[model samples]
Target: MALCEAEKTFVLHGVEENFRIDGREREDYRPMELETNIVSHAFGSARLRLANTDVLVAVKIEVDVPYPERPREGKLEFFVDCSANATPDFEGRGGEDLAVEISNSLAGAYRSPEVFDLTKLCILKGRKCWKIFVDILLLECGGNLYDAVSIAVKAALWDTRIPLVKSVTVDGNNIDMEVSEELHDCQKLDVTGAPIMVTVCKIGEQCIVDPSAAEELCSVGALVISVSRNKFSTILQTGSGSLHPQTLLECLQTGHKVAQRLHDALIETLVDIKPSENSVGFLR
Candidate 1:
């Protein structure tokens, strides 16, 4: 996201005036579009487009044994794939570093048990549990990737449905479980407390949320804060600039405020989403 001196100056002046180049306030996010159940094969799926930053999240459930230490808890894994279609620089393994960074941030954000309860996915203690694989695909790079990815992940989890376990039988050392035959007999994941990431970019002396590609280039440093309920789950600082303690606190406060609004808007949008007969993947 490189910009010339004049472009940077324009953005700086706009920020100083509390009006961005895109006609948004300093804390305003770009327009977003979300759709769920786009992948019929996966247990759940959702696609989100925050301006030009596009992300797709799919949840696949597999039965597996619980961990040795946490026998009653299930597992959640995150994988990020940056497609070459988004940018030529991501071809082959070029995007590995960025991919790992995003995936690790997601893992950390969901690490707290209070944010997402893995116990809900446990089938039989120590014997059987559902391992959820959250696969995220990046189709664009308009900026604010972390926020967009988190939103998509939450939407996918919200759309996910776990099959009902009807009965479980133990035959000596082996165990067999039967799932409900009815298609509608499923349980939805509780994502009310799911964390939402908000990127606070420092352009000049002002902090901004949801920076665009140009604004990202103008930023000296940025903080990615994950808000789960009323607390922060994780925080990562990026770029090559240092911030004072007071500035950091101010940035965190801004992130938390905007995250709450973002979370509320996401839930409202998801609730209003209706099943469409046609699939609107990337063709649109």
Candidate 2:
């Protein structure tokens, strides 16, 4: 409803002129701020804000027996909860539908063994394994929810530290594992292969990255694509509209390029993070 036929034409003209309705280039990403270790109760935590959309992620670990088939592999799960702060309608179960949809999409993205190595999380075969619970909280909804959540989740995972197991002993159905008491004795998750989602908003004939809520409402539809390094992880279509094949492919191309840049930027930021520094979550 935001874009009538005449207004759509104006938007198309802007895209053609290399200036979008929001006065941004076609490939420009919205400003993002990331903070880690905001939650003391969780093993790892991160909060990210992209323009207006904000999300928080926390990782928790639990002990449980390994599955019979994959005794050596541990468990990793994803859960998302939408907070009322995001929207008044999301006061209780109002946001559950959207939360489930986002969680399911993320789970599908990480389902493949190649995406995340759960096997490395196993401490003892058929006896003990670490179960990781990733909880995502949606704090605000401006636009580009998928991208913000993905970035926050990845940063949280990067900040996660797993305790080191000194030794594992099993004798006559009794198993004892020795864990390091030193707080410094921990290992970080290898998140190099983690994928990032990039959303491409399709207008008349062009695609824009990180569209704002107003601009988003003006779009006909959008595509959500997750990419890791140079590989395509997952591609999903959202919005109540259809895309042509060629346009879809073009949107994917845009998504890939944006995703690559996003991934690289995250890695650089994480690598440059000083261990002794403190995070400023939502204070700034």
The root-mean-square deviation over C-alpha atoms between each candidate and the true structure, in angstroms, is 2.6, 2.8
> Candidate 1 residues 1-284, lDDT tens each?
46789999999999989999999988888878788898989999999988889999999999999998999899999999999988777988889999999999999999889999999988888899999999999999888999999999999999999999999998887999999989789999999999999999988889999998889889988999999999999999988888888889989999999999989888877776666632223212
Model 1: what TM-score? 0.96
Which residue pairs in model 2 clash with each other?
A: none
Which portions of model 1 miss their true places by more than 4 Å?
276-284
- Which stretch of 10 consecutive residues in model 1 shows the poorest summed lDDT? 275-284
Worst lDDT window (10 residues) for model 2? 275-284
Error of 1 at 103 (Å): 0.8
